[model samples]
Target: MSSGAMSQKMTCDKSQDRHEEKVQSSCKQSPPGHMTDLGKEEVADNGRPEKKCVEEVQSLWTTEASGSVKLRIDELCPQEPITVHQMFINCVQKYGHLPALASKRKEKWEKITFSEYYRCCRMAAKSFLKLGLERFHSVAILGFNSEEWFFSAVGAVFAGGLSTGIYTTNSPEACHHVAKDSRANIIVIENQKQLDKILLIKDNLPHLKAIVQYSGSLKKKLPNLYSWEEFMRLGLDIPDKTLDDIISSQKANQCCVLIYTSGTTGAPKGVMLSHDNITWTARHASRAGDMQPAEIKQETIVSYLPLSHIAAQIYDLWTGIQWGELVYFAQPDALKGTLVNTLREATPSSHMGVPRVWEKMMEKIKLEVSRCAYLKKKLVTWAMSVSLEANLKYSKDEEKPFLFNLANSLVLEKLRAELGFSGCQKFFSGAAPIGSDTFEFFLGLNIHLYEAYGMSESSGPHFMSGPYTYRMESCGKVVPGCRCKIANVDADGSGEVCLWGRDVFMGYLNMKDKTVEAFDEEGWLCSGDLGKTDEDGFLYITGRIKELIITAGGENVPPVPIEDAVKRELPFISNAMLIGDKRKFLSMLLTIKCVINVETMEPTDDLSPEAVKFCQQLGSQATKVSDITGGKDKLLNQAIQDGIARVNSKATSNAQRIQKWIVLGKDFSVSGGELGPTMKLRRAAVLKMYHNEVETFYRELKK
Candidate 1:
């Protein structure tokens, strides 16, 4: 699309874009500070932009946005020749003997040095070359997080192929969609299970040339299927110089990874992130959670989040590779079990989790507290109160009471140890908006929970909280080399979060139409999500612009916070969505989180009102999550009502509170088409699926 056509295409969007609409608004628009050449804009700027990393946003947000002459973080910007392959080779030279990777084998963590990691990476790349993979082509990796997964991903990049990953939870049809769309030449899988999925759908994927299993041998051994070791052996004859030649020729603008978005609105779009994106992100992300110099050198991180998620790609993979940080592969199947144990053993210097992960951890802590002795419970309650007070005071930069110091050592320190957070100086939470209460709770325990903001389109970690500038509510100020602006705005300065930077993605793979739609003529990518910048340029993501619930009174209320509040009220709720766009009052659709640990495959403790009622329904026998979620129990129904009431109590007005709610008969899941790959709620899809329920809610209101 030409620049003129792009302008016409984004006409509707510009009106809604607060940054564009209120160009002349006086919001203390300060010029950005000079920075190192690492983050300088590469593309020519036709029209004058706000600054290199500064941007126009809500007037309310920037009325006092300037804070003590903020300067760009030059130290965290990417250096020259920023490519994944180049970066990996550079690390090998700098940290040759440093432990680069660790994967589980039976019961122990097997380690790999930086040089060894590069050698394996080169072997994988050489194998891809042997398979006839080339530049502009793609590779598909299907599996959970593993060392093999990393090797394959880097191998694809080293071989000059655009590498993309498929969520392990994706159905065969979904897998086929991505594989076919990407036109991947080689597809890498973990075991028989993932291989079987490809076999079921490979017939439709003519571009798929070979299948490489990362682990687990198949006796069948189809013509195109090869063991990972066999594939690696194919490149054994290839010299290290050949791999170096490819890495040296690699360009910064080459599409390195195709990260698929969560697809909350529609089908998943493969975001084409270039080598520049990865390196820039890797540099800034390493410094996003700002730790001590010593801590950075010896940083250990437990990698358990799905590597497919952009959060994991940055937090564990890319940053680890770039900074020579030690990464321990935690089992994806053990969020609370093997992962917790591994974190304890590793004592990782850094930790990161999505909202769900942290929420589950908080829930577990509460559950454990409930089971404590009376004396223990009393002491814990007292300590938590004192600690929460101290944390809140500390957040506001106020002097903490001396008692807080005592409480931190006496209770919080031990609590951190038990939860395997003893060495975590800064724990990151992102990929979803976390509740302030949850943040407070984490802070209460003396954990530095840094909320961040990024997407596959931005590589990852574009904006994040850090030790230097901590904010519980906002994600953080614009990252060192990135520009952030609240685009489509209203009278109050809330609208789309437009982004542009070195880390911004190339475009959606094989989707030129979407590519044009993603960015404006000025080169700013209009992020569909709604947010606002604080007085100090910190970002506070409110919700998706499309998901905003505007009531009949014309009041725009973000559903995310309300829905999050509702979910927190009930331990059983897996998801919640507020519905009131042009309606008189808000209503919610509630879905249950199974009373079993899906990851650990263990039944949750038979506590909670839902479990009690479920047991009663089953003639007082112990009941499973499937039973309670499928059937309607009186006690469970009442509990849902009480939970809604609790959420509504926080609403400032009746219009804002949930007036009606229905506990859905089933959970929203990826396979069910009600949730996205990351389990993010597909609000529109859910409303359409439950059209009758929603109508009944409004129909009864009319009657």
Candidate 2:
């Protein structure tokens, strides 16, 4: 189909999105009788017919409206030499009047329309070209999420310079590694803090030619440094038509970005994604997720997540451009206010989040519920349950039971308004392992938070929760058109997840042997993540293969399940490491949250045994995690054993409980360069750092 045909079809689908209307209508009908079967136990146990019940609804979500619309390759002919420049042309022509990028001024969010966004990016790109930046040259972008940071990246891309994105949270040493490794010629940074990080390593990186500072407040004397405004001024000499011609000469296979992996181990490696890689990934994602152009023009996205990450890059920026979506950037400190206000002003139809964001949202709800009157909380809970049941039954068969709808209107509608999610139609959560209970509860609120699963290597999405037909535990069926397989499984069937698809990265830049090793003889890229597919072919990730702990008896144990259990039982505990290779039993090193002293109000050194002792005395708190390892001494043996008897009760014969354990006071932090930005455990480095504590666990036992 032609682009015009695709546009018309998408416009038609926008006319058909009546989910909220259906929900409002359902609120007026009677309750479904079948719902009794779904929530009977909760009603019976609570001795209240109106009590809220938590249940999972299985519904199928499809993009039949948008999916049928197709675009031939001819529709997307490159008008520019590079992807970023081409995107600017797209924004100017298609979505000129729509807000394209946003930033904050005086604690208020300000928006720049698509045309304005294009103009800024073009000016920056032209400036780079004037600076003699050439194809394959590397430019590093460092700082908070800002308009300057984004436009500079577009500028680099327009000049045929590959951008190396570095998280502002990273240390000077980390910055040095990325700069030296990518051989960046120019560094675009936000402010003093970011510039300082670069300056600290400037002597270490001799290839670095210039430091482009965005904040105009930098008045200090520095060598080869340019201000953001000064850089844009240089572009004034370059004509718009000349820059357009430069953009048109760009090739799809040309390296556009040098995205560093959130390194689970060692130094971060640059993953080279070509212009084609990004465009195709965005296209595939848009198609699979039904990210329609009309939705872009209508939806408002609040961008606060680190722009350095691929998730932010693909979902927030690239996808937004394809559809003419408005982008909103929030100040780092005012994320909560910005997110809530943006949601209110934009009343966004679509939103994407991570596990941490969802957990905080739930915590906010709990906090609000705490402040509400008892009767109001009970009414809200009851209404939500009824609404969920009605939705489930109605979805199964479009028959609305009248009684249920009346109960829903009384309570559920109010609950949604309180959550500030009343207008949100579809939500997506990805990047971390989310609790199944939390996942189901959101579904009960009439909001489907599809928990997607994938890594940077997979171009950001491999599996997703079908917006309509979602399974609580499983990440949605392998995203449409992607093929995957399990490589070398153990007896219970879990194994390394391998994938081969159009979306997969070409390979780690300049690491030929490592790239070859990642793929099998047949070319399937081994995902290093351990997982299993249910009989229905739904993929469920358990843990990383390297993070899997094996006992002396060779019984493989995925620590994530156990660690998740430990953390659930103790939210104050930030990090936990289970260690036991050839030892007598599995033991864990717990890191408890540090508390401040009354006198100084300063955190008491937590890296001491006293903190562990204090946490142990707090009591044996426990919460059950599902579909995990089942053993005889399960309940009693599960909680970290304070003594021998408790330890004996928790472990099965072969997995016999933790013999000894120690608690560390300090929590792992990414800013400290201890944990990766993604929060994955760096076991070897962790073990090496705490070698004494680990040794004490076994050494004390030997005594």
Candidate 3:
């Protein structure tokens, strides 16, 4: 059947609503205590409260057995998907006066309300029709976050066209790969830099038609490129309602967004997410998060991450629209400046971040505390301890000790305010493994960061951690309805993680064989990650099965988890590669975090030549400062030596130790070719980069 026809045939029965546990407050009258299933003497086994089962009005939410679990996403949209055009319509109708998006233009913050946002998207769609951007035609967006970028994306979606976004940080080759692969006809690029990258390979993309540029200023000289203003002016004459009607009529199963894999295995694979796919995922996740519509007094969010990734789309755009929230897009380069000010000003109740961002925030916290008096540090530490304990207990649905909470308010409130997270109600961490210590550290500060795990193919979060029942190292319980099992276990029973759920993506776009391989004969997607579940059913992701090492001693070891542990303790460390595929013992190569001193404008000579050479020349003026000594030369020398010593001390033994390592003069990044878009190490690529060093290590061992 034709895709559109197939989508039209797909129908959702209201009886099959996946999220059945939701108690519409409008229909039910109950006290706040009647929310949670706890403290019910006459409660039914099915969790229905006999005496109006009480729900404790928690500031945050988690999907517990007693609470409402989100409905399966597939059930929500059924055959018809939730299109991007629909998101614009929903936001306009529900939150037209609210700021839909905020982006910087010419060093000033620019905002568009939900109504204006819908108008812009509609106009852009109309303009695209005028320009003949039609079904299945690819439009590639390349640049930092901006209102123009967003409008163009929505416009393309409204016109029944596929839209693909590239990270502005990506190199020309990466851009070329996506542009050519997507068969892009029209490209929206940010400024001359991104335009230049596309222009560099413009000749190579045979399908390329037009280059649309948006930025600080448009250069009149660029060839085959239309200026942002000029492009919008053409569409401005088109009525908004015309585009809206066209979008509303579009089928759900139609392609809404095209996301490319980070290419950890090889070249990027395009994953087509329909309006149904994204909308349902967002709906269920919001439900799982217990994001009640009433709780959204005024949703404010910071959208600074790269929009090319799924996390940014699901959380920033999709959730923002569904909940009638305001999204603040920061200037690409001024993330820190914008972040602190935005958080303080907006005081968003919900925020999501990768582990690294939180780590850096903690580092900043430490740096700030170093300047405070010793007594202040002691008080802060004591307060953090109390607050964290309260948070941990609170997560488990246990009441916080009254004394501890009192102590927390008296002491940690100041610390929380200093961190500019005083009003922050909920935070989520995903995309990578976060250490338990780091998790606990935030909880201690009364910042409940709900760490979850999922892949791009899974449509984002599958397992979630919240203020309850979290095992320090385990990712979290499988989000309701998602089932995970281990495959190919040894004597100890560790194996590859396989998952089956509605949140799973339809499949890689146009890659049937590849999709088949990802799933089993029974149709479960093999997550490619190595993990294990506890007796309590909590999921603990150990490592990647693909990156496992089998030592000569017949011991199979997963390296990523071990490497992750060591790296967490050493903040200066950037990347750690575990070596010992068929060797006597395990060893690793550690690279320190590289930083550029804002004042000096050069790589700080913070470590000794030997250690610096070992750590890949990770010199930063952004040191712990407390660890530095005397002057720049002295501090650099000591910092280098200290960074090496820190990593050396964190290793467990010969198997888990860094025997000999070299820090590179550079950092691993997507643009730099050392890291994947998902931030996973390109192992073979890194090994290739350090071939000589590997040879030296083997030779030294033999000697």
Off by over 4 Å in 1: 1-81, 239-242, 291-296, 396-399, 551-555, 568-574, 582-585, 592-594, 597-657, 670-673, 700-703
1-703, model 1: which lDDT tens digit per residue? 3332233224313222342222213212422122233345232111223122222232111011011111122444434434675566545545657887777766666777776666666667888888878666778999978878888888888887877889887789888888887888999998888888999999899888899987666768798788875786676556555655666566665567888876688788888776767866776655656732222366888888878778898778888876778888877576545678888888888898888778778777877887889999888878888988777767646767889878888887899998788877778888887876678778778776788888887888778788876776888888776777777677766788998676777667667678778878777778789888878898888788778888999987888888878766665566788899989888888766555546533335334444454446545443444444433455666767787888788887778888888767666656578867665778888889999989987896688
Best by TM-score: 1
Supply the global lDDT for candidate 1.
Answer: 0.71
Question: What lDDT would each prediction earn against the true structure?
Answer: 0.71, 0.62, 0.63
lDDT of 1 at 610: 49
Best by lDDT: 1
Clashing pairs in 1: 16-488, 17-487, 17-488, 17-489, 18-487, 18-488, 18-489, 65-535
RMSD of 1: 12.9
Q: Rank the candidates by TM-score, best first.
A: 1, 3, 2
Task: Tell me the tens digit of each residue's lDDT in model 2 across 531-598.
Answer: 89888778889888777777878876677776666665555455667787666668887654453343
Model 2: residue 114 alpha-carbon error in angstroms: 1.6
C-alpha positional error of residue 568 in candidate 2 after TM-score superposition, expressed in Å: 4.0
Judge candidate 2 at residue 268 and give its lDDT. 77
